[model samples]
Target: MEAERLRVRKDNSLLRKREPIPFTRESNYSTPVRPPDNDELPGEKKGLPWPVLLFLVTLVVPWILPIGPLRLSAYRIVLVVMVLPCLFMWLTGKVGRIRLTDIVVLSFCVWVFLSLIMVNGLSSSIEPSGIMFIETFGSYLLARCYIRGPDDFYNTVRALFLTNLFLFPFSLIEFVLGYNILHDMFSAILPTFNYPPMAARLGLSRVQSVFDHPILFGIFTGSTLALVHLVLGHGDNIARRFTRTAIVGTLAMMSLSGGPIQALAAQVFIIAWDSALKFLKSRWQIFLSLLALATIATEILAKRSLLEIMIATFTFDPLSYWFRRLIWSYGWASVLNHPFFGVGLERWERPDWMPPSIDNIWLYYAVHHGLPAAGLLLLAVAFAIWAACSAKALDSRLCAYRMGFIATLMAFFLTGWTVHYWGAAHCLFLFLMGSGAWMLERKANTGIELKTDTIKRIPSSHQRPSPHRNAFTRRILSETKLQISRKELPVLNPKGKVADLLP
Candidate 1:
């Protein structure tokens, strides 16, 4: 009777112990199932996401299509294709959390919509306003959804880099031949739109390449230089990185646009600052103090606004300075007069002698959309910069890239004071903003998840013991006392007899 009772107890304990072993194994295995790092996940196909691929198509299509009479550019066509996908993503919850940056962007769009209606009236403005909203805010949301992680961001950069590489030869030809073959070919097929006279500087023709103007080409190439650097910075292979860097740098110089050169300089400066600040104990405080001092010194020394100084420094044209001064003076007056809702999109009533073009982008927005709209736009940019700088949880290299993006943006904004960017270049601004916001949100969420996991891993004193604790303890003690491996232990069968687990 005693032997039977002992056998029954042993069988019960073994069965209980077996159950907990599987559970412990499962927990141990699953504990390592972490969120993906900056690598392609298993079974994930390595390719650009659909929306990103579509965005790249948009960038290339503009160069291929003839400048049509109806303003049906390639950008419009691709944006139309993007609409359904973006809407579906939003409805299906594929689009991630709505963030503050998103809210600001949307608000800016709404303000632009209202400005158009107020200035142009509801009936006349609906179509153009819709197009603008779709082109700007819609594009931004698409980027935000598609560029969810580092892989997507790098893919986008690669796409841009490839596009630039393809165009580099054409750009060089245009400069050397002092003529644009692509534009000429397209113009033959479609009604030739009026373009500015090709300007010459330093014995070279200012080449527009595949773009509408030299300034646009310069800005595009310059901004891309920063992105190329970002990609090359993270590369493990030194030879590959050096080769790519050389190619991109050579292409950037070939464009010979002051705007891009300024942008490239700005990126280099920001990168150096980032590197230097890392060594400082109070980096943020020191950086801010330096920034303030620099701003004050610039104001005192220049005696003109920093915008004017930047414009003067980048341009060799004697008339460029006077022209920008006149535009700013007239543009500011118009903005103040129509401070709430801008004067209708109609040409500002100025003395016939005054220049029509408001070269400054901020002034352009203010003059057309009112101060409120411009303010929201600036605020959105501010939010993007803040997000980039504050993203502490991102990979260090990615954080550096984000800072480089911010620098690129700042350079563009500064350049906008001298040159007007429309079409694809303007879209690039929204892309950067959306990308920055997405990265910031992703890093923050990952950090939060890690913290939650850490907290969950900590044992609580109030936790109850498992129901099978005594059985588990007995089984473990028996195995230890017997000095046997788990394979040597007896397994319980339906008939309550010891069975060999191993063959």
Candidate 2:
């Protein structure tokens, strides 16, 4: 028994006090180190500086650039080239993973395709452009997938607000300077007039800002301005808040596309929307400011003989009051004539006979796609809204985007009564709303909220063993390398240490 115990002690000593192996250049093949924290590395964070910058820049180009035959509209062109290619890449898995929102949007687009195919069979002019609308929406849905988290979302919202901020200065300048700037700016490219009478006559010509037309400008800016106020609220600083309030309010007002009465009323509605959305303390402040704006607008309109101004400004025909009603009647008649698979997208407009009289968007849908198409479209819209409202309430950044998107839609809904600008921006906003919905659904599925920063813990593979950093691991790897160089591992001495083995 004593001999066996001595033998065991000797074996334990051999194991505990193994001699160190001599170092070589090859000894550098060491164990890999891992970071202690599970947080995602900075390199992994998504950076979209260029795309976001270009996107924001595109939104305001309409106001700053000269409009003519040759000057390319950046806003329209980006949608075709940048948006389409990116979308295709996403669908094919060449780009990042497409989110659930993208799938939903694509499904809806497929529905549009099937419907449009039927439209084309029925009416030849209902060409592929109608289908392309769904395609555009799909692109936006995919574009948003690149947005990784809350910071990305906040960046987008900031870009949106800053882009829209240009409206304040542009409209204000137009309102104060009247026709002088407009005539001078357009004179080089546009047909020069002797006196530029149209400019002076129109009194700021309802300056469309960056948008293509006055009415579109009014609606777009009005909606966004209202949305900003709604999200930001009237905070502590009275001066800054009121200044923004005045600028946006004035822009909406000076946009005389609504003439005097409608302009005043739209501003009131904008204020009311903002007031309704504000916190209790700020709510009263907004309400009082809104009342002041109303009083001022009313006084101005009364003095200017607003009703006469409106009559004169809007008088596009001999029996002006009846003309819109007459056109709408014709529009309804057209819808009745082609109820199912209505007039094709290209077929609906005839600039020669009359300047595309189907101004009402709801009616326009009915006229273009029939009751089934219109009904399906409305149902999709209703679902999107319900989804947005029912989903988790967004943070301030997301709130701005959501409110901006919805407000823009509402503006379109109202503007459809008079004009049609729902081609690109309309689809963009829809896709964004859908994407937002998808984000919420994803959050729910993960059983996590946006604010959480927990990193996903991927299990290490069998081939990649658990990171044990014992001397054997380093010794084995180094000896393996040296053996590859010298053609075999060095023989070990009876002491079981490579160092003890000499040549």
The 10-residue segment of model 2 with minimum total lDDT is 444-453
TM-score winner: 1
Clashing pairs in 1: none
For model 1, give the 10-residue run with minimal summed lDDT.
446-455
Best-matching candidate per lDDT: 1
Cα lDDT tens digits for candidate 2, 1-503: 69657755664554454453433323322222222211122213554446545655655553223345333344445554566666666778664455444555555445455556675663543335433553346436434544444445434544555555755665667666654354356445544324322233243455654455555555555544544454343232667655555556566556565432243344456456654776664654675687777767866876643333444454343364455555567777877887876775546633356667554556766777676655655555555555555556344444544554445444544444555445334544454454444334323211101111322232333222222223343444343222122222232222323321112
**Candidate 2 clashes between residue pairs 3 or more apart in a chain or in different chains:** 62-210, 63-210
lDDT of each: 0.67, 0.48
- Backbone clashes (count) for model 1: 0
